[model samples]
Target: MRPFYCLTFICLSFAAAAQGVDPAITERPPSAAQLPGVDAPPGPAPRPTPPAARPSPAPSAESSSPLPDKDPASRVERLDALFADLKRASTSATADRTVDKIQAEWAASGSATADLMLIWAGEAVTDKRNGAAFDFLDQAILMKPDFAEAWNRRATLNYIASDYGKSLADIERTLQLEPRHFGALMGLGAILEATDRKAQALEAYVRVLEIYPTLKGAQDAVGRLSEELAGQRI
Candidate 1:
């Protein structure tokens, strides 16, 4: 089986009332794994939006340039070091830099073509070109089934256009490749919360916090869920 590595970089976003688009199809999306069809809470589903760019397309082979390989041994060592720095960071500002460094490490797929396709797919998603994005991502995954980022990305698109089952499948594949993927875990948590699996959702968020304690979003989710769950048990 192909081994992949995924980071839990996604979360459920309850789009603020002010965040709506004009009555037209446009924009990006997010994650979760409490598969669909559960008694999920009544709310907008999580969507798949492109993550922050790692420099920036399905791109032509001729146009692609060689990228440095993320040699597993070296990259893992670096990530371990970075995670340590991230947790020790005293401020969000300081931790943010470490967070970016870790994600940059995670984004490298060794294959320039796959990277290009991922960039193209992100652009397509941003431009409301879901079909194009799908094509780009599909080609990327075909080319690199071991690409954890690719699987995580497809999971986002699957949830947006298809169903939770398909998205979760991709997510699980990502985790299979990289169990430390906090981003995938965040996606799982969000989906669980949406699907009315509050206990499971809390567990997921706690897992994320274990990886990145400075993440305010996870802290917020944990706090919110704790109160809600406590009330239920009361």
Candidate 2:
């Protein structure tokens, strides 16, 4: 969710090898429902890490100052328009562009300092120092408490560490700030599935599909959960 400042953003690959983190910990199903026509390959899982000991900060614990000194009303208006367009996009290409633009805006903290913290957090993740990455991201959130990307990335780190409870907590924060975050919604679905909350997971995936119809992961999850639930009912 961290905006790609200088054209560099968090890989979001979920399972990049360089990070020694398995994407599966984030969502570990045999990916099938192909993206368009091609099957999306599974990324390697990273070595298992224990959950963090400390409790996650409450959703209300974010720094009091959640915005930059300069008002970002115009940017908010632009993003809202793009989101509206995304919802109505008739073509895949148009939807893709709209998604990209929306995500870019979501990543921007409008503060260089906060952005740098995000970059550092990413680097920590790459180095396989997830604990360190969490610290960096916590600071980022403190500096820009309203930055959804910071909460999103931190949630990702908790997911990677297999701390589902913490991950879910942070995810709640992310969604609170950005309800339209399909990525967080997908993540919520994965965590729900992993925790044996199948019905909730299905609902989460369904929501993601409603937002981004072409998202292959959500498609696959929805199919899998639907089949599982149907078999149970039968």
Candidate 3:
């Protein structure tokens, strides 16, 4: 139950954020200091990304559709444009392409070491080696505190591990770093819905739509939560 609550918290938070873009209302996310291994000393220094792990970035719509600059500010600009394109996307194929580009941008964490670490973490997850994934993600975050996707990945890990408290914290941080993250928003909505926070969940799913109007899951969540809440009111 608690674990579900954690995922739901992330989902609800995300959905709500999707509806609103409020940077002023901040929530603490999982930081290195807050998770289990603050004092455990750093993991091994990141090695060169394994050939297979350094998989290609998500496919881009054009060879040069967005910014190629790698600074945080430039990443923001690139994401801003992709998000705009995402909002205007009329078909699922267009939306997915834009989403892939956005994910690719998230994967580019400035620090080559951190990026490689993230790739390793992703591979670990695929291999069902969550412990390894956690270690890699932790190190990645350690190296690049501003890498929102690392936090988001950890959030999913926490959710899968039934560590909702940590997952929710990670979700909060992910949103703080990148508020327009619909994936995180979806997680927040799931947590809220799981915990019976219907009104909040409804609000969250609604917001997700604001950012990504074509999202079928958020749309379904909104529809159901709205009907349920309305029935309760009646």
Candidate 4:
């Protein structure tokens, strides 16, 4: 009976071995549903990113430049103001100072308006400010090449400055443009006088007097030349 029992145990052991513990099963990789949360701990609220810095604007070419303050219009207005003040200046020194101020302002102001510049040039000549007068008148001529008044003013200034050759050239231009320009005629007379062409100066003065009998300086010039001609027995 014991042998039979042993045989039965052996049979059972054999059956278990035959079933050969199925090879150990391996686990499959986890699917998306079983994996760790993609939206897990909403990490400490993300810090707000600062905005990028913007580049500074480049400077403008015009704004960066240091230019003279006076333009043509401004120069005209300033010169007119200076002339107005000159009328009130008490002494020669004060007048000279005003003239200097105007010239300096003009220099700083660049080109001036043609008409105003001509007026300023005439004022300079009246004050015997030859250098300033010539500068202003020359500028006027340059600005308006065919401007008869400008040419005439320049001629008068040149004559006063003893620049007779330039004066003659300018006067010729003036006469070419306006034959009846009395100022130019007077300039021609003055130039002749300086060159000792007394006869020619007298003729020129007489012509001017004929045109405008009440001309301020021509009467004196005529009287002086008449006496000079008599003295020379011509």
The lDDT leader among the candidates is 3
Please write out the lDDT profile of model 2 over residues 78-121, one tens digit for every residue.
Answer: 87798778668776667666766666566568776666566566
- Would you give me the overall lDDT of model 4? 0.47
Candidate 1, TM-score vs. the true structure?
0.70
User: What tens digits encode model 3's per-residue C-alpha lDDT throughout 1-234?
Assistant: 000112333323222222221111112111111111011224554455446656568767774454557455777788899899989999766776676576667666788778666666655654567788788889889999998877877887787777767877987898788777776666666656666677876766676677767666666777887889989999
- How many pairs collide in each candidate, listed in order? 16, 4, 18, 0
lDDT per residue for candidate 4 within 1-234, as digits (tens), equals: 000001121112112212221000001000000000001113331223556999856779865744335355665577577766655666545644553454334222133365445545444543556566567657667877766655655554455456778867876786675453434566677667767888887776676555334443556678888999999996
TM-scores for all predictions: 0.70, 0.69, 0.72, 0.46
The lDDT for every candidate, in the order shown, is 0.57, 0.59, 0.60, 0.47
| Candidate 1 vs 2: which has more lDDT | 2
Residue-level lDDT for 165 in candidate 4: 86
In model 3, which runs have C-alpha deviations exceeding 4 angstroms?
Answer: 1-46, 49-68
The per-prediction CA RMSD against the true structure, in angstroms, equals: 12.0, 12.7, 10.7, 50.7
Q: lDDT of candidate 2?
A: 0.59
Clashes of 2: 4
Off by over 4 Å in 1: 1-70
Question: Which stretches of model 2 miss by more than 4 angstroms?
Answer: 1-70, 90-93
